[model samples]
Target: MIIKTLVHIPLYNKATTIVRTLNSVFDQNYKDFDILIINDGSTDESLELVKNINHHRIIIHSQENKGVSATRNNAILFARENNYKRIAFLDGDDFWCSNHLSTLCALFDKFPEAHIAATNYQLKRSRKTIDTVLSNFESTEDQLLKSFFHHNYLNSIFTCSTLMIKPEIVDKTGLFNESLTHFEDIDWFVRIGMKSKIAFSFRVTAVIDEIADNRSDQVEMKYRKLPDFTDYEAEAKNHLGLEKYIDLNRFAIALAYRMENDIRNTTLYQQKINLKNLSLKQQQLLKMSSLQLKSLKRTQKVLGNLGLHLRAGD
Candidate 1:
């Protein structure tokens, strides 16, 4: 499987870490790839810093201050035009272990039919560390539709930087949604994951530098996973117009409301039926909302007495 991959690094005000990030890519154990650096309207000397690296294989694309989604969209166009089979990404603030590419290559070799591969990485703060694990998945469209009922499997994987996907999948997934300011990855992943299997790399070959101000880190808190349901629920309801998706959205909103102690929103979301107008399952779902609401309150009271404060619903 001697295919070429394009590693797109989108840079903005990452002057402090851009060099290290690029160095890590050059240090990759597997070298059959081209590095494309998109200097997205950086006012700092980030571009100058990148030029000092002196790598011939690196191609630089400069644009005035486009957002990440746009930068990535351009990179995809470049990869497609150049005929790259695989596309891997590294944010300017993150760096990968030497074996990052080799590990993904090996996985793709093993699963010829797989369209995407992702690896587990260390989620790091200034000095502390949090470990997360993601596994490779092979799912059909039907299984994916069902999984959405329980949870969004792809989001647990975290960060687009960890994913290595085929170009065709990117094209099919329609690149990152330009309008979203956050959870863009989740939106794109759920769409693509519905069509292809996602595989995880068992090795921890990347370091996701979760700086204090980093968007995800700033929004972090203990017992925070529950609030995440709101974003997906909204995205599903508004962006994806499938009826099955509406059912799943109700279930998720119900969970988020339960977490935030909002019984009313919880019940309201739970009561919607999917009809000609709504489905029978949806009608049944509305009926059970009250029960779920009561149980949620009971659990919250126990937790509150035990000294846990619920953050307002996200």
Candidate 2:
């Protein structure tokens, strides 16, 4: 039987949520898909749980702890060899809605020219759930690239879990950058946007759990490497003009430093850049002294205890 779509899931130590993630896939309305779960040396019960499932279409591959990028690349290679027509990604800890696959298939059928398609998603934060959709400014692929460069502080676009694309697009754009410990999805999306038209749907189709103690948070704490934006700077400038690229670079540098906990450098970069587009709290934080910033963090914790959460992204 011809596989219509190859669902690639990269599993780390996500035993707690792996079964729920798989259940979401198994419940999808679209049935012409095969599931590939790449176990990236998960020391937990993740692999055992995956094997306990009785689904014949599910295939689990085990390997030493290669990061997410390498695991995804392995799935891509498997899809290419097996002649899968389309590719979709779902991290083992996240899940999709019942109609997610059916909606994407319909979108591809509607827009034959679109090589990439993404659906909106819901973000499960600490206190409450928030729905996120692509901005109205991102109507076309070029516009999406522009919006992303200018205002992708939190990666508002559909993340890897909500994205589906044709295999030929992967052939043209290549695979995710293994060197990037973070922002690998953003880098891949930029490349894909440059090569083909990206289709967007406002329909919410996935749930992304963004709790504080996730694997990504742990990785960021242990391995602090700045994401390189130099590669896409020229392309961004060419597509969205020079000023926008400058703004994008400023934000990227500040974000990279912020991720590395270099508050001094983060504040310096934020100061040198424009602040009109940033949220009021973000601006205040950037201008605050180190001691003041620490006080604000304490205040944030207090607010959280009072059931009032303040997101930096606003």
Candidate 3:
């Protein structure tokens, strides 16, 4: 009666979307699985709604507000203790396509060497209504690690919702870094790609609802994880593509810091990036004050209104 898979869900104040997520899990074509829902101090009706479901296959764990990383680690720890062969992560606010587990599971069966697998996931932006592939995972680990190091806007692929990994891999690679409030998954993704074999599909099996909203100038940046790539820099010395990817990583970090109006840290990351990797305009934008950048964004929006769109990277 050993479950082959454990769907790890970290719940917060997601009463509205929790049911949708669980229903997707229930609708999966793959049935040899159990669910571990770790409610991370949700002050909403989320826990009660899940309690009412009364499904036998679901195991519930509730605790005070620990961030997503801690909750995810809890689920992995649970999976290890319960002897599950596979673990899939699904956030409270996200849901999966029915074939998600089946697709990932089949990858493991087909590629015995692959310790990690994921299906393509799409962004359902209510306003634009387009299916976008988040990550185009490469065939080789080197290619994957390179692609992973790049920002999501440019050929970004993996997501927690779409990913499935063998619990055994955690032993060699390690769990999510609890200290990182953001980019923890990417940090782990890099490590996984470096340490284990990863397999991915082009087929979409998860859906993330990105409610279209205005680009906030004053984006919050509390506890953002600054990924340390010092160790990888030596690896990049041999591969120029990897060198560009390292700069790209710095670019992404600088952008996040810029978004929070922290120019000092933004400059720190920007200083590490190769100026050639960025466009002339992007380079100039990086030097601008946050207020000036916000004004430029307003201008971009106005141009969009006139049917002239400008890419953020450009």
Candidate 4:
């Protein structure tokens, strides 16, 4: 049974949703794909569930807990080793729509020159759901890089589950930066966008389950240090280390302070940077942000301080 595409699901204690995630793949309308479950040091019943599944097409790799970047990198290598031409990613907690794989295969057939194709996602949280997709724009590398500087439109546009990429291109650009916790995908996408055009579909092909275990929220509460998220700040300081970017990070900290309505802390943070040095554009944006910060008031601060008791990233 030759595999045209390998769908990798990186799991880490996703006991609650692992079954649903795997089921989605098994239920796909497209059948040329194989499933590989990378157990990233999970201490839950996730492995037991995988063991119970009698599907020969499913492959499992159980190893000591490595971060998502390392696990994903291993997944890519696994796919390549199996002679797969295309690779796709689906988080253990997220599931793809039935047509998701079929659509991607068709798109690949039509656009052989495209190295990547990403679809929209349905963001689900509590009883609320929001559908997000990419807007019309030139998919050129330069255009995508310039767009990142303005805003992160790709967050909603391309999620882990909706992405399908050529194995060769991924090998050339290198794998996920295991050093990064947050923005790892963004960094990878930026590199990919630079190397080849990213074709996008407005169709909602995946459901991003935003449940109670968001990792980002845990980091914000000081419960744990998510190394990947820290890598961005570290790299900024180590590589570019531009004062402006540092200032931006500080400004973000200040915004966090403002969000908490800790005026004293906010002022202390503000003192670290020379307000006079801010570029006119940044200055204007900060000013507007400051006003919005005020509107959030003290109540929101209490809620944030209470903590996001659930999932970090959806």
For this target, which candidate reaches the highest lDDT against the unseen true structure?
Answer: 3
Overall local distance difference test of candidate 3: 0.70
- Report lDDT (CA) for all predictions: 0.62, 0.68, 0.70, 0.63
* Per-residue lDDT value at 213 in model 1: 27
Error of 1 at 217 (Å): 6.3
Q: How far in Å is the alpha carbon of 157 misplaced in model 3?
A: 1.5
RMSD of each predicted structure: 9.0, 5.1, 5.4, 6.6
lDDT of 3 at 122: 69
Error of 1 at 73 (Å): 1.1
Write the residue-wise lDDT of candidate 3 on 1-314 in tens digits. 88889999888777778888899999999999999999889888989999999999899999998778889998998998989989999877678888999988888887778888877666654365445533334452322234334324344466788889898898878998887665566567667755777776778888765442211111255544556566666666544356665565566667656756987888777888878866566676677776876776653343232222221100
Off by over 4 Å in 4: 133-155, 212-217, 221-314
The positional error of residue 65 in candidate 3, measured at the CA in angstroms, is: 1.7
Which model scores highest in TM-score?
A: 3
Model 4, residue 11: displacement in angstroms? 0.9
The TM-scores, one per candidate, come to 0.66, 0.82, 0.83, 0.72
Error of 4 at 122 (Å): 1.0
By TM-score, the better pick of 2 and 3 is: 3
The Cα error of candidate 2 at residue 217, in Å, is 2.2
lDDT of 4 by residue, 6-119 (tens): 998888888888889899998899988888888888888889998899798888888897678788898888877879988889888888899899877777776677778777
**Candidate 2 Cα outliers beyond 4 Å, as residue runs:** 137-155, 220-222, 241-283, 298-314
Clash counts per candidate, in order, are: 9, 0, 4, 16
Rank candidates, TM-score, best first. Answer: 3, 2, 4, 1
